[model samples]
Target chain A: MVTETQQRLDETHAAAAPVIEVRELVKVYKGGTRAVDGVSFTVAEGEFFGFLGPNGAGKTTTIRILATLLRPTSGSAKVSGIDVLAHPGEVRREVGFAMQTVAVDPLATGRENLELIGRLRRVPASELQGRIDELLVLMKLTESQKKVVGTYSGGMKRRLDLATALLHRPKVLFLDEPTEGLDPQSRNALWEELESVNRSGTTMFLTTHYMEEADRLCKRIAIVDEGKIVVEGTPAELKRTVGNDVVELQLEADSPNELERQRSGIGRMLEGFEPVAEIKSSPAGVQLYVSDAAAAIPELVRRLDGDGIRIGALTMHQPSLDDVFMRYTGKTIREEQANVHFTGWY
Target chain B: MIGVAYETFLLGRRAFLRWARVPGNWISTLFFPLIQLVLFSQLFKDIIQLPGFKESSYLAYLAPGQIVFAVFLGVSWVGINLLMDYHNGYLDKLRVTPINRISILFGEMVPLFVTCAMMAAVILVTSLALGASLVTGIPGALGILALSGLFGIAWAGTSFVPALITKNEQAAGSLSLLFFPLAFMSTAFVPVERMPGWLQVVNNWNPISYVIEAQRALMSTGFDAGLIGKALLAMAILFIVTQAATIWAFRRLTA
Candidate 1:
């Protein structure tokens, strides 16, 4: 429940200092596959930033480089003001990474998995138990903490993996598709958890192919494709670039010619209206692209009244992030399957 | 250096727990060695009376070989554990930690010492339970476990090198089988005199034979310092060579 003023203050604070900065980072694999090509961005402290893209669009590769898991072929990245190449160990200490694949040990119990990572991250022995207990409860996994992770459900494994990453309370968290394969319910639950984590002042850098995830979680997002960021802005700002809210009118027409006549009649009536940007015909009735559909709906109804064009249903909706993606990339994202690439030392 | 040791201890404990929690790991490792120890001892009971046999029974001579065999079996697929981590992105998880990278490798290696020794102990206890004598008794049994543990640590490089080089689970697994001839050609199944002329010549240089001979002395012939020294030297040489190659492979994979 962030108030408008509080969010504005937080944004102001974030803009005052940058926690992560990348300058033309590039990663070219052995066979000349340029995974990340000249990507550059800076994340303000406390900002929730995301790279929204289809898979193989370099989101994972860029996040991996920032997390100090992979080396770049050219350019530079810094986390918490530490150069990733020059001082990766220092960068590692300040950040936590939850990979796309769940990395928990199936044989180890949930508690053991957290304990191992906590110890490796140098969480003090005195505080480790308390932290694990807190996280287990937070993740709603207290009852199953002693059970081996192999017995946990997929959502439970994901929660446990996230718990391990949060163990050390890193300053910056890098999540690569944190909820990629989750059911809708689990995905929503994890989204709430992530929002709470970001609200606690941890700078978040996330990469995902889910448009809804980016719209819901990221304060700012970069739409990436073909190893380049095609567009970057807040979700609302990006969506606004796609132009105008849509108001579709379902009409009561007995014949196709009557429907066409009614459609042209509505179009001719709304043509001179200041708020309506454009009017187009549809199979059922007419569609209006309006600057503010809610404000323009009354005027629209008045114009259509007594024209023998009866309206059965009216629906108004804002342009969605997918529309924004399609506006830039010229293809819908829903049909694209994730192209998962293994950049291991093969 | 101290940081590496600490990290290794912590991660090694996890690796050991991962092995111990799974019943299949120990069951599979001990199955072949136990079958050979029980069946072969009875099947070739009269082979001991041929010419060069000194033990009172074939089981006595067969116990030490089974102990070494258990060590071999315990380490054969140890590298696949690391490869699993690599495939599952657990390796990347560990890499992002602030600890030294070598700790990950050492962590996997250190636990083999305990598991190999424990597996060897099971065979030793079973052999004694079946009426095989331990001349030097409990102290001898402890010595045998120590040797097995050390030998297990040294021999694990065979599995690790292929795993890291190929980065393929099947290749790593099959390549470990290529070392089975080393185990079979050693003195595990026969004394040097009972072997063919060419095999006996091969036995003189076989590191597994040195370890088996030392364990055999502890089991029946009493403590032989010369035999123990030769076994230690052999393990040291093998450890240096295999581990060198293993380190190189690990570096290349991780680099």
Candidate 2:
């Protein structure tokens, strides 16, 4: 028996607002080094947002600021519509932080750690044990719950950490490199668990170096570099921004002198392909970005053959999060990761 | 407010559970100062024979000093625990919780205070067993132990600065070593008047000297309000300064 005007008002009010909002956030260290340089983004409710970056790219700093663990030098952040700086205690109640490093007490059992955090978070004592039991089953740590954290494996500990973060069923969860050092199986298991959590209508903000994790798990991603976000979009949209397919062609050079000439010729030759949108070249090979890789390949080989350029090797792939990262950061994520030197207590 | 008290209670329990789970941690904090007590009293037994010494039993004179040493040593270990928490990301995790920050610090400290009290109680009993009677009786001895616990808290406040600044257990270890020099420089082993004039001037400036003298006064004569007030003032000043430093350290750490 609701009137049309009343129904419209209800619908408007029911629309989901962003669970996380950050604007022009800056964090400068003591020596005037900006760890987070005016970074900004928003995470809509129930969206699994991924932050991809190299080490020291300020991803962790931004996460820390948003989590209310570290204060920002400038700008503003809001969690669950509450101003983080002004009401951090309120913000904390709405968000859960699982740090990059494992934070469980080594002397405490898995159940004890969760129980302690659950109590600190003010989960009702009546519901606390049931929630812990549910989390233990969800994290697949039921059998190991009695053992102290020191006895748990790396994967088990990470699961326990995630369980701790989820104990209160926070509206927004911030996970900083949640599976950094886990093996493939453990990483996959954790990812699956996280996916189920996100599906339960929790807003997720995670920072990770793993492309597959971001690709498979995150619905949207922001690539941060040198303390600022270089690009942000849905996974499909971001991959589309850099073209759908990557065509890597190694030019056959008869001698060392011809290598440079052949690379440039191959690069110029691929530029005229109708389906190709961008071309990049290095000493090892030439890469072409194409809208339709299957349509461009036959035409691509024809041009190379007609130009008298030998195709030493040719491979094509659907553009991956890796290509999107490389295109924005000017280096492969792996290369950047290798060059990163971690110093101090981090 | 209730939430903070609840969190503090849980966190304090966690700290005690750490001691219970690892008996070695409690053992070391408790027994290390006991060894120092026995060694110093036996070695400095002849110092009381010097002129101007009022106590017939040197152990009685040294008992208060040993209690101060034990409490200080036990309390300073809080720094090591805090440093470990920092390195392991436990503090950062805790910071994200809704619990009050002051609760985080005070909860961690409650167990250390307990350790200090236990160390003092054991040392007091040992001194009594060695025939060192308190002129003011058991009540006076309890007062002395309570004062030692206060001093332990002040000293622990100072220790937090180094722990947060260096963020290493080795730095905490080095700071503990520094405490030994401070202990020896004071009248812990001898009366301030018996020391050289320059050393006595330095001891007068030492907060530990006030604590030792306060405890000694309680044990040797009776409850002297003047001595206790002076000791309390010295400890208050030290507590204010060191607690300020510890708060600054917490700021730098979170910053």
Candidate 3:
């Protein structure tokens, strides 16, 4: 009783099969800090997967585990189906990682850096120079190819580092905040480069706290907090899960009296509305997670007018990645970034 | 392993390119030793008088010692670069590359070895300008330089232990005090025979003395196979300690 629907389902499942699978991964530092605790996810083949987490949320620990740099305290991971623990060397061969840190030799030129990586990857001697040339151009490092890395700007060094990782052309590439501190131009260029890389048939696993970048680049994302996958799905899927719309009302003033009054005033307005799934307020503003933002906004404004409570302004928009993170983790990405991250470490 | 070796060579090229891009670094590496030689030779010649039998040999003794000092000072700077790479996000990049992780450590060592060799050559040249020829013939003299390069390797190798202890450059540089005393306690400046009994015993065990004595043996008497053997053996022992220390440090931290 074979059916066409069943065949289609099988083909879809095959398309979504993960190239990277990490299950129950745990990493406990010496001081009893469980950096990565029981996190699990699968990065599907050809998917641009994002690991979105704040600093100290275990993104680096998880990345380190997959890269075979730091062994997990428990659990197992497979990269390109190779067991990370049992076959680190094999795992290394199939995965290219551009770590958060820059490790390029300052004494060497960009060309030399690429050539060295080419040779290390055992690219045939005849093909080495061509690979170097291609990577140099791709990174926009051709102008500085013969110049030492010490003289290169931060963006240039980062591009060169990325170029070295790309030189080997592995099945999957791990980029940890690939454009964290770059200028807007450089960051956009790197994003464009990554798009082309994905188009070339290599899966990219990225970790970043930049919500917009994740929304722009990743087909799927795992929002991580406290060393766990709080939720995972496409940027659109996760945003959709936050219901349909976000309702915001700015507080007219910074006074405590105004803040408390505004909080309870908005609270009363949406109390009995079922489609208004959630009402959350903070110092900056009040937000309503609603099923239909446009329909509720006129009604909401009427209540404020009837009560004689001032509405600074009200606007409704689709749920953003930040709202999704807040819905799942009870804190915004900026809060998490501020807590453990160096203000300039990006 | 061959792949690892090639990566190390390639990475060394990168480090070299960094220096070439900044020509000031090359000038400093070439000239730093000569400045130290002239400064220290004049300072010691005036200040602390050691019982070295004759003032005539003071400059001779200072010459070999400066070469050792210059090599160590120049080579140990490699650790700072390694630590900088870590801080600047470069070391982390290398960690995940398909290139052997050992290449990261070995790559640092190669440029270090080259830098030490060059500084030694500079000091040797300056010694020649001061009318100092190895009382040992030219062939014997080159051997001295070769052995001194090993001392530099051992010194630079030993630095990895501190690197593993702390990723902070300031902390690593501060800890270099331990290595400085080992050089001073050696007979690099004066023969152990002139020391008091207890100090002489300590001097005998100091590894740098073996290196200095090995060079002194060659400079004082050319092509003595037995002395060269003992010196080489001693240098080998220190080299082993350093190499082992570096490998163990890297394995312990990285694993």
Query: In angstroms, how far off is A334's CA in candidate 1?
Result: 2.0
Q: In candidate 3, residue A343 scores what lDDT? A: 18
What share of the reference contacts is kept in model 3? 0.79
Q: Give the clash count for each candidate.
A: 0, 0, 16
Please identify which of the two predictions, 1 or 3, would achieve the higher DockQ against the true structure: 1
* Candidate 1: stretches off by over 4 Å: A1-17, A246-316
Clashing pairs in 1: none
Candidate 2 docking band: high
lDDT of 1 by residue, A140-206 (tens): 9999999989999999999999999999998999999999889999999999999988998999999
Least accurate stretch of 10 residues (summed lDDT) in model 3 chain A?
A: A337-346
Off by over 4 Å in 3: A1-17, A253-258, A272-277, A290-296, A306-310, A341-346, B12-57, B110-113
State which candidate has the highest DockQ: 2
lDDT of each: 0.90, 0.84, 0.76
Best by lDDT: 1
Per-candidate RMSD, Å: 6.9, 4.3, 4.5
Tens-digit lDDT track of model 2 for B137-224: 8789779778877887888876788887888788767876776788889877788778898898888789999998889988888888
